[model samples]
Target chain A: MLYTFSEVLEKVNNEVKDLKFERKPYSLFEPIEYILEIGGKRVRPVLATMAYNLYKADIEKTIPIALAIEIFHNFTLLHDDLMDRADKRRGKPTVHIKWNDNTAVLSGDAMLIEAYREIAKSPKEALPEILNLFTDTATEICCGQQLDMEFEQRLNVTTDEYLEMIRLKTAVLLACSLKCGAMAANAPESDADALYDFGINIGLAFQLMDDLLDVYGDPATFGKRIGGDILCNKKTYLQITALKSPETGKEMQDWINKEVFDEQEKIDAVTGLYNKLNLKGLSEEMIESYYQKGLSCLNKVQVDDNRKRELRNLAESLLTRKS
Target chain B: MLYTFSEVLEKVNNEVKDLKFERKPYSLFEPIEYILEIGGKRVRPVLATMAYNLYKADIEKTIPIALAIEIFHNFTLLHDDLMDRADKRRGKPTVHIKWNDNTAVLSGDAMLIEAYREIAKSPKEALPEILNLFTDTATEICCGQQLDMEFEQRLNVTTDEYLEMIRLKTAVLLACSLKCGAMAANAPESDADALYDFGINIGLAFQLMDDLLDVYGDPATFGKRIGGDILCNKKTYLQITALKSPETGKEMQDWINKEVFDEQEKIDAVTGLYNKLNLKGLSEEMIESYYQKGLSCLNKVQVDDNRKRELRNLAESLLTRKS
Candidate 1:
């Protein structure tokens, strides 16, 4: 399973690495290359390939769709950095930070178009379905981004709203990857839809765990600072769910409404309260429930038992991991 | 000529206003309507219709193609505003400023895809050809945008370099508009290619005139501040060509190097120097030269002389515009 995942990651990195030349002899391309090169876990593309392999082991055929997924993912990261005003991505300077906002936007635009071009490379008969899925996925991701922006200034947002936002913003693209890969491999529509469900469920679980880890995980091993979301006052799943907790709702609102506080003190207070509320455990349980549902979706697909076993095992490995 | 131009503008505006809602929710549709309402001249799309009218008078058939051009144009503007950190576009706040950077980028992304879908609406015989031209135009627009960015800080650019940049940035899409229109109307390939040259030349001429008007036009008529390019230190044709003159080179460099000056005073001084070097007249002469070349291209097309007269009259009208 590790080798299979690595195989998909390799192609994703390759496609993302060989972006168009940095025309005009400037270092603007550096930040773009920087964010893409600094490395992600390649989870989306891996799900695409693994999902395809669940029905058919055509790794070669699935590579391009996986590559498309990865490109689209990175493209989002580029623009999201601007929205987040994030200076660093993956421990490296972001596209907008390193280059001016203009270059960042242009390069991101180019990357997105390239993603579609890559997706359109599938065989003619296979293309319309995959293209339709890719188009729908892109729009869903946009809607997710819009919702994420809406979450920022809207204090009335509920946990369900946050969940939907994350699903659109993060999960749908991951699902599209799997769906595209299966469609490319000529899987039946039912199997492709099942794969989509499986990927989207995992993606939701993955984001849920991310919200948990941001507050509860060991910073050294987590590859991010504990409570980074609290530091930024980002509207994440844990924050929303914790705020939505009937008993804690009023107090949490008071904390969030405070305009001025010591930075570290705010982080400390938020982290302490989140832990006291058992939100981490709640997150863990909910994430596992989604994973179980995802596994059931996989099992329901009409594929060979061995293939199903491999997929079920892979999902377990991802869901149960700490890092 | 004015009647034809107004007729085209009105029809394009009406057709563009008539977008069918394939997706739910009005907010998703707002950006497109917002941009169209900002009231551009519909220059590219009109060029498309005019070019098609040259070979075939059934110009109604090209509406989808023309709308595709408009969509692509707005997509560029949306993303460009994000890149430029521009606050207002045509007296309204930019998409990024009004909504958020993520919405701007995503809306722009969706606009580009929708443009492709619209382009794909041509007859099947024209579909592949239009896609090819659209893709090529899309690539050129990116390259052109990259060059425009490159020109910002670049000091050694000559008139030829500036022309090349504008040709790609402003002209290619215009050329693509005409070419796509011709293809959609099933005009002869030679007529399409010739019309492409005409549109490209005319587009370049129009951008040059815009540069001229930026410094010289009445604020009310121009709908914005005069000398905006000078204020921004834009390396436009006037500035670049003025700098290219051996005598004005030193004076141009001085003004450019000046870190501080009163806005009106600085604009006056630069305008004075450009006048002294006759850069405006030079630009005027160059514009006329291209207009002639455009007309010459129009002449070479094998279409009936009477039908060709419509495009030629439009060119003449654009040549004589005051604002």
Candidate 2:
């Protein structure tokens, strides 16, 4: 009765599509519907659902929590896009651009509320725990985002600091999503903790892979300009490592301090320095370490290895994903 | 053993003061502490505590819910000030003015998560109902704000439409505050419903009085400058009524459409037209009606009259206060 990755993904998509934003104050609800409709991979909710499928066959009971995670993820994206002043998300105009800043702020707030309402629909016995976990995860994400913003202004950010920031900003919700699903299935507490740990490692690896793909992936497959992070001087793991290395630190700083430069030249220069440092090999090593650590945690779960197949495949796919 | 209104207010204030924002990423939490520190009347929490006091002697048990309401209210104000492009709140610089818009948005979001975290600390039996009530109320407030913003660009907003907007934007939180306290106290559902009704009516009256005072209160007592709303062409209850009136509609439109004029002259002319139309009297009647309706609902609560005294006093003070 275990749902495969695509099956869980389909289930999550169906639930999101079924949500009606037909409330009054169409301005507030329309953006929510718009963002939800212009969907991404549904990664968070699918993670939640697949995690649930690891322990229980009653996938129907997990839909609300799954949708909650998805909606919450979208809420964060909506606000983050506004904060970053980015013009697009998933290749479509962001809410602030589509409507206005006020609409983005208000609708984003409502979406957070909507996420909580969905979480509250959990079985009464599990509501309190799920609610607490979700809130704590949410708070961490905010702090993570704050740190990410703060790091943007500084040049001395360490690799550890960057990892911690991504952990808070990105990984914890992934952890929470997995743990919530396990909890909903009445999984043993130890098993749930194991799943949470699995999520954290995989999430860290997942984000690292994103950073890696931004620099190394083919443009036709990456779905974005490959040198975006480089052109913007984003302090990803590779950049942080390159900046910390004595061999490349001086040159990296010179490049970052440039008032203006040709975009391709800067990208090429940074890419060349990263190559000299063998940053690609190092980042891959880090990614592989976390990916293996995630597998170890998954191995500790009390569930049979067969039941863990889809989740295993997901982690593998994420590590190897080109886009 | 029921706590007095002042006692509850003191408790709520003390709890707010004691909340530590010492977590990492001080930039994210500092603004949260800053907004909470500047403070307000603590109305929502006080209402919650007093409502709890009516049914139980254990006011300590209600502190988490009370603080939750207070923090949530401040969070809304933080974002609202940003959206309104407001420079000041309560005679002090707002969070956005003090920090930045991104800070305001992120910190406001964090405050919301903080509120839910506090609410989760409520007695487990009451958590579900309170969380649902809170989520619903939060969504309504967002809708209310959206409508308020939408109404700004239109010239034909009806009295009912305006009332509905205020009810959603301003009144529901008040209602939710009272009901949450009652729920925490394990009040009977019927009694809780009555308290909610009382909150709604009084909240409507409270907002109406704010609109009235903006136009008619003594400058010495109103704290804020009178006719500021008029100067900005804010669509308050008085302006909406004036717009709907045959006697004053044309002149009001003339004044509203003028692109250039003295601020005081515009205020005076608007005040004169309001006087000629008796908007002051009409607004007062509307406030009085809501106040009476509130009292009637309070009367339906099964609590002894003696236990209702502080709440009754608070409501009366709200109706009569100039500022």
Candidate 3:
């Protein structure tokens, strides 16, 4: 009776589409609808739903959790976009741009409250654990964002620091989503812990893939301009690894230190240095290691292998995604 | 034994002082500590604790709820200050000014999560109801803020609309604080509902008193400069009411429409218009009406009159306070 990955994704999409925002003060709710409509992959909620389906056939129970995670994710994006001063997301103007910074701030706050409201709808017995996990994850994301901002000011951010930042900023929510789903289904503690571990590793590898694709992804397939991380001197895994190289470290620093240069030229130069240093291979090896570790954790979940097939498929697809 | 209002206030203040922010990254937690340390009345938590004390002698059990309401209130202020571009709160530079806008945004978010985490520590049986109330109130506050912002751009706001805005923005949290405490103490639902009513009326009156103080109070006694609302052309009840006056409505619009005027001169002229229109008397009548209504709600609470004494005193002090 378990749904496949795409089936759960469709369910989540429909639920998101069906979300009612009839509240007054339309300004507050309109931006919420706008951000939800201009959607991303819906990965967190789908993972949550799929994780819940692994333990129970009745997926209806997890709908609120799914919406909660999706809404919470979008809330973070709304505020983060404002903080990053990002103009567009999903090929449309971001909330702050579409509305205003104050709207983004207030709407994002409401979205977080809405997320809590949705999550609280879980079966009463499971509420406390799920709420605690979600809150802890939320706090960690804020810490991760702070670290990411701090890193932007310093030149010597190490690889470990970068990995830790991504772990908090990007990985923990993915892990929490799965754990919340498992808890909602009344899964055994051991199995839930294993699923959480699986999520963490997959999430780490997922972010590493994002870093790799920014420099090496095919421009046509990547869906964003290639080498954007380079032009911005973002402290990605590839960049951090390249900076550690004895052979090309100086050249990487020189490119980063350029006060004025053509954007494409800088991208080309730093990317060439990455190619010379074989950073692409190093990053791929790291990603493979994390992916393997993730699979090993999945092996410990104690579910029949067939029941895990969709989750495993989803993880593999994430590893190989082009855009 | 029930703790007196001042005793509960002391406990709440001590708990706030004892809050630790040892977590990294310090950048995120530091501003939270800063905002908390620059204290206000701690009114919401004190109200919660006092409401809980009305039924149960175990005020200790309400600490988490008290802290939750207090932290949530501070979180609102942090974001509200940023949204309003307010530079000072409690006579200190605001989070956005002392740190930066991004820090204010992220740190405010963290405070909110922290608030939920604390609230979840309530006795398990009471957690769900308290959380639901908190979340709804939080959403309403955001809606209220949106309305407030929207009103700033328009001049035709009605008095009823103005009342609704303050009820959402300022009053509900007070009401929620009381109801949460009542729920935590396992009071009869009737008494809890009555306390909420009392809170709403008192909160409305509290805000009206604030509006009255802004224009007519002794300048030396009012902590802020008198006539701040007038100078900013804020759409408070006083302004909205004056806009409705037939005799002086035209003059009121002129002052508001003026592109240039001496600040003191504008304050003086507006004060004169308000005097001629009897706005001060009208506003005081509204405040007295709400205060009386609040007392009647308090009268319905099943608790002994003795248990209600301190809460009544607090309301009286709030009504008469200049600053």
Candidate 4:
């Protein structure tokens, strides 16, 4: 019942799947390949194919579009790694760390241009609409990133504000992926719009769950340490919601204001307080609400129940992921 | 003839011009706008258009193609400034210097993506060949830049070796612009091939003149201090040719072997030696030879005398520039 239906999407993914770097004279290609092969979940492309699958029988027709989304996503990560001065991503050396900032910057630029090349090759019939949607979504993502960067500097960022930022930066691309897929499959316009909304709600839920996992999940399951977000003082839903809470708000701020006791200690104490105040349960409830919204949007689509069931099951599987 | 016949080239350059950076959030766009507004001669676009015009009358319709070339050129410059730690370009501060490296990098990526967007928008008639040419040219430009960076480290770069390096680093894009324009115009394959060769030879000549002017041109016309290349110990044609000449060869090698020298004294002494060996005269002869070769290539293109003559006049004008 899982959507193994997108064999073409799988082929497209595999076409680019870990293609060899094939080093050139004075090559900048290798480090970029290193970063790309470091093993991401390939979420954007998957979403694109899944979304497209809901609308059309010919999923392979949208492979180039899916490739565009994947490449664009990778380009962002390459540049972001440089800005973050991050040393590792997915247990492999960051491009900038492995090569240098200059290589990372230029290779990332090349990768981005490559994404456009992929878009340009899409079936001409769907070109204009898909290009517009992709461009618009890319812009929104950039805006989201800017806010995320700005958030690190602000002394005040409300939970609602963080939600808006993530919705722009991360959710829109996910939504656009589905919309693009639908457009490619020549699905009814109404169905495409509904699918877009559904993807957005699912995306929002996914990010909120990510926020929850940072605080409460086990390290072995998450593949990264839990409470790492608190150590970095990131403005997540748990922290922002806890800060705005009436009962223990000021004390939490006081604890945050401290020249941060031990990093792990700060994370553990705050996480413990989140448990005491039932913040985790509250975040979980909010996540569930969004999931329901997603399911409702899914129900609004006119697809057969079996296919619809598969999609719902897929979304559920996403939520059930331990990592 | 118009003194700068390159205008014919400029007018036709757009056939292959790809512009329109993929939109990023408004926050990342400010620096891109700031950088693009700083003026340049846009010589590469002109060369592309001019070379392309020689083959087809409909070249004007290829504006998107030319825009692509211009945007990609600027994209490289933006990233190069960051790598060079350069603070200014065309009398304005660089993107990275004006904003921050993060912004410059992200914006530059956006700009590169935009170049492809413009390419993708090419009239369907002009797409397949245009994209292939653009991709090959763009990749070559990257390879050239990598070589330029690599040259900074090696000590024994010879005359032939240095020619090959600059031919790639500076001249290939100019040549590519011309070739791309030809592709856009859907000129006879024969014309495209000849113009490509002419562009390559003309580029070699133009770069030689630039190297010559760097040491010997009048200050008012040249816009920057002459001999800056010599001061930086850049391996240029003059040094290479002088080192290859029997009389001055060993002395030139000795001069280059020293890691540091007084700037004014070194410039004056080197210029004196180059004159004594008649190295500038040799360089002028070689430049003329390539120019002649370029003219011969232009002769092979079956075009109207008026248009061909205009391109010829443009090449001649470049030879005479004091700058």
Q: What are the per-candidate TM-scores when only chain A is compared? A: 0.91, 0.99, 0.98, 0.92
lDDT of 3 at A148: 91
For model 3 chain A, give the 10-residue run with minimal summed lDDT. Answer: A237-246
Error (Å) of candidate 2 at residue B159 is: 0.5
Q: Residue B177 in candidate 2 has what lDDT?
A: 94
Q: Model 2, B1-323: lDDT tens per residue?
A: 97888888888889999998788888899999998999888899999999999999989999999999989999989999999999999899999999999999999999999999999988899988999999999989998888988888988999999999999989999999999999999999999999999999999999999988998999998989899999878889888878889889988888888999998999999999999888888888999999999999999999899999999999999999978
Give the alpha carbon lDDT tens digit for every residue of B1-323 in model 3. 87887899899999999998889998899999999999988989999999999988888899999999889999999999999999999899999999899999999999999999999998899999998999999999999999999999888999999999999999999999999999999999999999999999999999999988999989888989999999999888878877888878898999999989999999999889888878899899999999999999999999899999999998899899988
Stretches off by above 4 angstroms in model 4 are: A1-13, A52-62, A127-132, A243-260, A272-278, A300-302, A308-310, B1-26, B47-60, B158-164, B239-260, B270-278
Better of 1 and 3 by TM-score: 3
Q: List the residue pairs that clash in candidate 3.
A: none
lDDT of model 3, residue A194: 91
Let me know the DockQ for model 1: 0.36
DockQ agreement of candidate 3 with the native complex:
0.93
| Residue B213 displacement (Å), model 4 | 1.9
Instruction: Name the lDDT value of residue B42 in candidate 4.
Output: 69
lDDT of each: 0.78, 0.92, 0.92, 0.75
The 10-residue segment of model 2 chain B with minimum total lDDT is B2-11
User: Model 1 lDDT vs. the true structure?
Assistant: 0.78
